[model samples]
Target: MAETTTDSVLVTESVAKYDGAETARKQPPPEKPADVRRRSLVIVSFWLIVLCLGLPIWWQTTTIYRAKLPLDDMLDWAEGRACRPVFPLRISVEANDLQQQEAQNLLRLTQHALDDLNDFSGHHLRLQLSPPGRQNESAEIEDTSALTIRLLPGDSPASALHPYSSILDITYPPNSVPTQTSSSSALATYIAGQLRSTFAEEQAIISYLLSTTSFSNEQRPQGLTPEAAESLAKRTTRSLKYSPTYHLTFSLFTGGHQPSSWDIEAAVDEFMRPVLDVLTPIHNFTIDTQIQLYAAPSVQSQVLNKEDLSSFVNAAEWPLSPSIGGAPTVNFIAYIGNQTIGLPPTDQDASDGALATSQSWLVPQWGTVYLLPLPEDTTHVSVLTLKQPLLTFTSHLLSLLGTPQSGSLPLRLSTLSRIRSADLLLRASSTLGSLARLSLALPSISIPSSVADGVAKTMAHLRLACDTLGTPEALYHARVAEQEAERAFFEKSMVGQLYFPDEHKIAVYLPLLGPVGVPLVMGLLNELKAWRKRRREALEKGKAKKDT
Candidate 1:
């Protein structure tokens, strides 16, 4: 009983001790709910402010503005889908004495024959019959027809091409005319042969052009030989790329200051006006003539060999800079000197036979320079004296513009237009393809709205140019298209912003994120520890009460 009582006393003391401890703990220690709420509110408010205001402002300040581009349309324009060029040449027939039915039959048969003979579908010749007895209708016909076929009854069959005019004179017996029922006739066959021969060079050139370009091989003539292809390639490479206008600079370069001036204006008007007038459809030329004295070539050897030809220009000393405008410059230089060209002879005596002749050379797209030996004291050149040089320049200009060497001036100029159009179309397309590849290659490059705007403008202009190709207006639109495409593809800002590296971005972000994140994370960890301690104390008090 005594031990039990002793145990009871001990138990009672322990209980008393526990009660005292419980009462001391139940004093409800600081009731930090307000502090907890205040701390949470501080954090929550800070995060809310950062997310609502700071993040958006940061994004707005750092984000790049991207604009939409019409990439597909641009690619299509470059691929030749936007334009398929066609040349429809008009040919008028003048049959003064033939009856209406006979003339119509001839026309039908000629059309069939010409179509059968024509391999180049791009340049189709259409025949139109002029009313009989029309006076000097040749002048009126010249305005519309590329060429006029004049038929006259004679004793025998013969044909002649009228110089200075595009007239094909064919004399035939009156009985040779086809009847309405006839499918073919001798006159028709003769005309077809004549027409084919006339346009043979043009057909070869056009076929060669189609083959060299991105145009499908199915449309190109398969008959072009390797030699022909090589020649065409040379011609195309030698020619200047197309522009709306061409600046022709006529320079008279002399080693000495004897002939300071020439009647170049008068000479050009006399010798070159006709050709210029003919070429006006393909290119607008601006002529500026100047006399440059004391211009010495790099090689001053008495005899010039093949190597001397290249260094003769003295590009460093010559004032042959391209003109300020967008048009290309063609330089025509008449270098007055006594230096002889030492060309290697094909035969042993060919150089000796040609020693006395003046040396003239064509400088690709630049121009021609004719080395003329003149009297030492002559001060002025007559128009007659300037004739050969001017004529050479005219030929060089034609060659530089890629005109066919074997055709009428009108026909060559027409061909030049077609070639230039194809060149420009391909150039624009290639530029577009490059831009597309660039965009694909660089993901971070910011494409500005201006680039998109330029791309759209380029595509629109390209479409217009393609639609109007082979016309006078096509050049204008093509020029615009080319300029716009260049601008779009080479947009400055696209490349300008590429200098900043990814490392720099990471460096910039690290400072702010590092400092701010540490404090917020530590504060949340301390709050969690305090909450766990309070819950453990409450659970132990409940267990002690249940045991008592």
Candidate 2:
């Protein structure tokens, strides 16, 4: 009985120990919900602070502001759909000696003939009969006609152009007049042929210009000879780009101080004024003359060859700086020297004097320098002495302005206006095309609102320019269009941000995003895992109780 009691005591002690341990395990670990809640609140508050404060600052720093642009409208203007240039040249027929009915019939026949002969549809000549009262004073009448065809009775039909006026004098017999019922006449054919010959150079130049540009190639003249085309290309390339105003700078360049002063002002007024007055319709010119002493040609040889002509102008020393305005500068230099131009000594004409000539030569678009051999003591050039040089300079200036080599000054100036308008229109179109291409090529380029504004202005002006093309006002509108197109295409901000590459963007964004993203992501993951563990523990406990 004693042994059994001792065993019961041992068993009771073991049961007490087991029960104490079970009670300790079931106490739920002091209920630390406050700590967990505080920790979660801290983590969420940190994330909220970062999200509210950091992201906005990064976006504000890195964001690019893109401005709206009117690219489509600009492109439309550039495509030649906005405007079509037309030149309706009015030619008055002064037939004071003919009856009104005869004159009308002749005019109608001539119009038909001219229309048949014309290949270029852009330039058309409209024929009109001058009133008897204005026939005699047709030379003074500037507004109605570009040219007047004066019909006089003669033995055989012959034509002579008036030297001082835009008059084509045609001597035709009285029988040459067209009959009322006739659709064609010898007189009409003669008149058409005369008109074509007179305007042949202008037409060729215009045709060549059209061929060289982006205008439809199929419409270009196919009859232009290779030599003629080459010559035209050279002339066009040498000429200054069209502008409403042009600055003419007459400079006297001398190797020594002997010939310093020249009567250029008086000389230009005398020799160049008439030509300038005629050219006024197309280009407004400003004249400024200067004399540069101690200026030497690039070549020191006594004789100049064709190769030396390129380096003849002392570009470094000459003060032929372009005028400070919108217009381009045309320099005319009169260099005082004794150097002669000749073919270089070769196998054929090595010692022949026939190969050599005067040293003066034209420097394409820059100017012409006449090597005048004067007395060492002479300091001033008289107006009479300057007459030849000034005249030569004037001719060179005409060529540089792309004036037609044929035709009178009035006709050349008119043609120049047409050519200039065409050139500016093409240039503006090309600029717009380039801008469109650029925008397409560089996707990251940020276009500014200024570009958009400029494009809109360009398109509007281009439309006006195109509509008024071949008219005097076309030049004004074309200038505006070109300026605006250039401004839009070369907007400063568009290219500013292009140099910043994608690698640079990544480098800029990685630092702030990488550091800040890590803590937020980890905190969310930890919260999710804890919630899943708690739900699983509750489910297992319910299952265990059910099984029991």
Q: Residues 412-517, candidate 1, lDDT per residue (tens digit)?
A: 5655665666566567766876787677666667888888877777677767766765565666666676778788777787777667777888999989888887
Please give, for residues 1-548, the per-residue lDDT of candidate 2 as tens digits: 99999999999999999999999988877437788788779888887887898779867875666666555754554554544445677888888888899989898999999999998876788898888978557656545467888888898899998766788899998777778888789989999999999988877776776677555544455677899898787677667766678888888888887676888899999999888988877778988888788887889998777666677777787778686586778877777887877753342222211122253555555556676777778889999988888888788778778887777666667668777777777788778877876776777777777887777787777778777766777777878888888888777777676687889978987896787688788988898787688779889999999999
- Please give the lDDT score at residue 195 for candidate 1: 78
Alpha-carbon lDDT, every model: 0.76, 0.76
- The reply for model 1, stretches above 4 Å from the true place, is 1-51, 61-63, 154-159, 213-223, 344-358, 446-470, 495-548
Model 1 poorest ten-residue lDDT run = 347-356
Indicate the worst ten consecutive residues by lDDT in candidate 2. 347-356
Q: Spell out the clash pairs found in candidate 2.
A: none
To one decimal, what is the Cα RMSD in angstroms of model 2 from the true structure? 6.6
